[model samples]
Target: MLLGVVLTVLCLPFLWWYFFLQKFKSLSAIPGPRPLPLIGNALDVGDTPTALFNNCAKLLDQYGDIFKVFIANECKVFIANADFLEEIMTSNVHITKSNGYYLLKPFLNFGLLTSSGSKWKRRRKLITPTFHFKILDQFLDIFNASSDILVKKLFNEVGKESTDVCPYIHLFSLDVICETAMGVKISSQEGKNSEYVNSLIHYFDIFIVRFFSAWRRFDFLFKFAPEYPIQEKYLETLQKFSTSVIKKRRLEKSQEVVETTSDLGIKRRVALLDLLLESDDLTNDDIKEEINTFMFEGHDTTASGVTFALLALAENPEVQQKVYDEVLAVVGDETYVSMQHLQDTKYLEMVIKEVQRKYGAVPFVERQLEMDATIRGVHFPRGTTLNLYLYGVHHNEKYFPEPEKFDPDRFLPHRQSERHNYAFVPFSAGPRNCVGQKFAMLAMKVIIIKILKTFKIIQVPDHKPQLGMAAVLKSYNGVRIRLIRRDTD
Candidate 1:
């Protein structure tokens, strides 16, 4: 017992030096927010994550571009400058999606959204082709059809009884994901009670709350002390929803496989899932993960972007009028839009881009250091967490003149052009950038064109929209707009 105590005492210093030394090492020379003992800035951050990020940007005004804050459990660096953001994003590893993203691991599993290294690489490769530009037309049709349902549903309840439309728009997006990705048309707008969609969205808040407040990071605890079948329930719900549709499609396609062998190689209707399901690399588990990733990524982001664009147009009448005219002149006498009509709505695209720039939906693309990387003369330690400060960068007057002003002309081909590649990144940056960017753009254009062509959008007197930040930017009170049907040209 005496000898064992002697050995244990000697080994303790080496362990302390290895772990504790790096905590105070190189970056101690650089200045950052003063961390309170034990708790650090966790107590100060309160419930406002967005405001906390904005204040972190403000810290750069005092502490320059690179400053650390002991947020949650670690000292995270906030990089506000476009140049530094560009350098880190463009040059960094494609796999730089954060280690702190373990917050999502319970909900996402080793799924593409939260997984790293070989799993991410393999899954991304298998699924990347699922979002090619050529496939966007199918998604455009889904968007326009869903927008019709949304508008029709809203039009019925239109007796100057304008209510917040965020949830409805999210329904449209969710429904679109069902049709476009999974080969199921869930009439979410027709009857707005979507328990599975609701459950899936519910997991986000639960995961985020636990991530910040709980002693265990959502995943770390799950490794030993598993969830009380809530995540499993959600997975089962999503799987059942997806698998039922997949089973039907496989049945339909099984007939096609037979017909192709028997009756002259005729094709059947194909979907994003069909493309993914037909792929060589993906396994059955991988296909399920890809579908789950699409369900989360498709609706949350597309809905937020569409919601913000409508809010922007509702706020600015001139922009709305310009969009209306462009739509009327270009789109033909069709009840709903086709893919070509979507491309022709130039002003509508500008409005979407401008709104995305001003109120970026998924504001910041976070990155973890894969290797030691120098961002603007400052070297970030390997394993350091970097928040992109996308909303901060968008609001910067340096890259965008009169940054607060909502100007669509910035996206025009000439005169006012792109200042930096990273300046207006609502879709995000790098190889890991949004795979469905073109489809997202097309989907938004179709919705905007359909709405602008039919209705003159006016903001309701009692309904002033405010930017509500969650996992994404959406109005807490849905955007309430009074829509008068345009009777004449």
Candidate 2:
């Protein structure tokens, strides 16, 4: 009798689950990798970040643009079709981010990137104004100053064979975000690594590891695991750094009078942190989450974008010369790259756009369906997680002919008009797209124009990097470029 009772209790849950899954019989008709009886296709999923990324690519190739895969019996639909992506991105009901983003909760703690519902809506409203054109214009000075330091650092390696520009650009971006976002200067270009920065990198690495490992997804198991202690240590480091900066900035704000006018009768100075601090609806913890989010998003995304842009320029000398010529024509030996210069360098902008299409810093965006919806006549039930494969879409030959080739002309005004709006979404699309995209583009233009004007980037021979998936898209081996100094006329 005892044995029968135990079996009946266990069978009840399984029966319930089996019946629950049956209601989604419509989704079962969608083709995907064959699943095991209980664990489904979870074991077939890759164990490492790179493996997982590669597996997704392979599945897309085999299963076509839209297909399903079971992650421990939960059906996930991967969509690479541009139309489907547009439908998903534009839908108001599907605005909530996927559960996968919850992995960042321990780090970001309901920052704009991870929050949902009314909190996300309110936070988005509060933060959107911080990246206005006028505000970002003030940050140009910060961008130029940091670029000057980066150029000086690179000059030390001029004509001394190939140097890995990845670390240098990473530090340059770090400094830019610090000054512009946090209203503080870390001078990371000086080559002195901070504990905060080291911990930041370590935390991202740990997050990726934990994200891919099924065993670590369970809170109880991950908490007791050996990796948990290391993760906690880095988490503490990040929290400590962010909180300290917030408190320091708060103290400064408290001491200063609220100035409504500048020397030129313009509006007062605005920093990202200041905007957050001024909001009555937010607390110190809210400010910290946003600070950490901006620091991570603003710095790392641009770093990857700029690094890949440099790599592309190095591989294509003709393209590099064109950008250099455009810079010279636009700015004409001016030590400073102003907003006018940024606007006038149209060719350089196309090159950057092409680079983003080929190597977007963010490879994918995930969304969870809040209600049942039909995308291109296919039904997706509520609670289904959708992975919008931006990278795959960018590489799809149907959208971009000869996708492997680096061609900036693809983004010419005429050419862009011919393509689908959703085809090239490096910053994503629709309402929840990246808020600071303009700021990022302006910063990249300033730095790239500085570097290209100073030196001709040369690609190392036989050195195509194998990219790995982390929080951002990164190469297993760092991006190495040889710099040949340009003749001063």
Candidate 3:
């Protein structure tokens, strides 16, 4: 009996290896760079965000649209082809997010972005109503108010030869998300140097470092790293912040101070927190998880979008002038943008869409398949992670001509009609796509129009943005551009 126990214990590693090899055999038809043993192709992807971004581009260029790689024996099949992306992205069955999202569970828990199966479906249904058109329109007041603060802050950078727009945009986005979704205003823009704000930013930094480090990906191994304690400290602060907000909002609800009307007596909408609080089903813990999720998703993603849009516009004078013309024509010297104004800026919409294509804020999305699937006659076994490389698809020359060039007209009706629907997915696509896409778009438009109305974005001739991949795409060196104050009559 003692010998049998020892033998069983000894066989476990071999059994695991045998199954791992079988999975690889099943996916052998797919092409990828040769992976090293144990670590697999992890090193080929690089340890830094910039290197990772560049190396992934090289791999795509070398291997074409569909390829597979193994990270620590885990199979990840990357899909740059639109048809393959359409299949997995639109499917109802393969909606489980890839295992990489597990890293976010400590910070975000099982919120909409990280949750799967019935829980995700339920939470999605609950949260969808909060972003309804009526509510979104009301939220415009918050957006405009926050953007006004951002425009004021930019006054300090007006005469400078170059200003990094990323930090300013980050604070603006944080304020907007807090007011619109979390039902609280932490005044992050005013308190940019505060402990809370610094900790929040550092939390994201640590998360991305862990994401790229092969040795730190697993919790068992991460605990041994220096970042573990620092991450824990920041995560605790973030969680405490979320919990405190939830409790404060709950108290406000109990006191009946939560108003559904404005000072002018117009019918006002409640925040997402109000709606969630009204629901009998969600506990405080559940609400806290979602708050953290939206805070990061809504804040960082929009910051990236607006920052890149400014850089792109700065670099492309013709495009910037065209967008400015559209804004002037649609808005007609109005200090505030109404919903109709947002709708009528058709050309600006095109520019924003092009920005999404050329510089997608969230570079890629991942999903783990639950069932065996075949795409273009290539078999992908169950549990294979499908990386929908949005960056690669957006840059595919077959779809976008002169892919590196910034051209807003690529989204013109006739041109857009020429490509596949999945070809440009900055907010991702289908069932599990971002719930705040419309919110993000309106927020971005408000900020962009405000900035353009007040200042002309000028590119620094020699300076260029250094792009890096984190929770969102960011410029490690900052998005530098000169802002000249506009003379408005």
RMSD values for the candidates in order, in angstroms, are 4.6, 3.1, 3.1
Global lDDT of each candidate: 0.70, 0.84, 0.86
Q: Give the per-residue lDDT of model 2 (tens digit) for 205-314.
A: 77887777777876788898788998899899889877887887777678763245433565545678987898888998999889888987888899999999999999
| Candidate 2 lDDT for residue 286 | 91
TM-score-wise, the better of 1 and 3 is 3
- lDDT, candidate 3, 17-136, per-residue tens: 667868768778788988765567888888888877888888888988778887775788878889888887888888998888999988898999999999999999999887899989
Among all windows of 10 consecutive residues in model 1, the one with the lowest summed lDDT is 258-267
TM-score for candidate 2, residues paired by index: 0.92
Pick out the ten consecutive residues of candidate 3 with the lowest summed lDDT: 260-269
The number of the candidate with the highest TM-score is: 3
Model 3 ranges with Cα > 4 A deviation: 1-19, 260-269
Order candidates by TM-score, high to low.
Answer: 3, 2, 1
TM-score of 3: 0.94
User: Against the true structure, candidate 3 has what lDDT?
Assistant: 0.86
Q: Compose the digit string of candidate 1's lDDT tens values, residues 339-457.
A: 67777877777788888888888766677776676556666677677777777677777777787798998889773454777777777677567777887888878787777767777
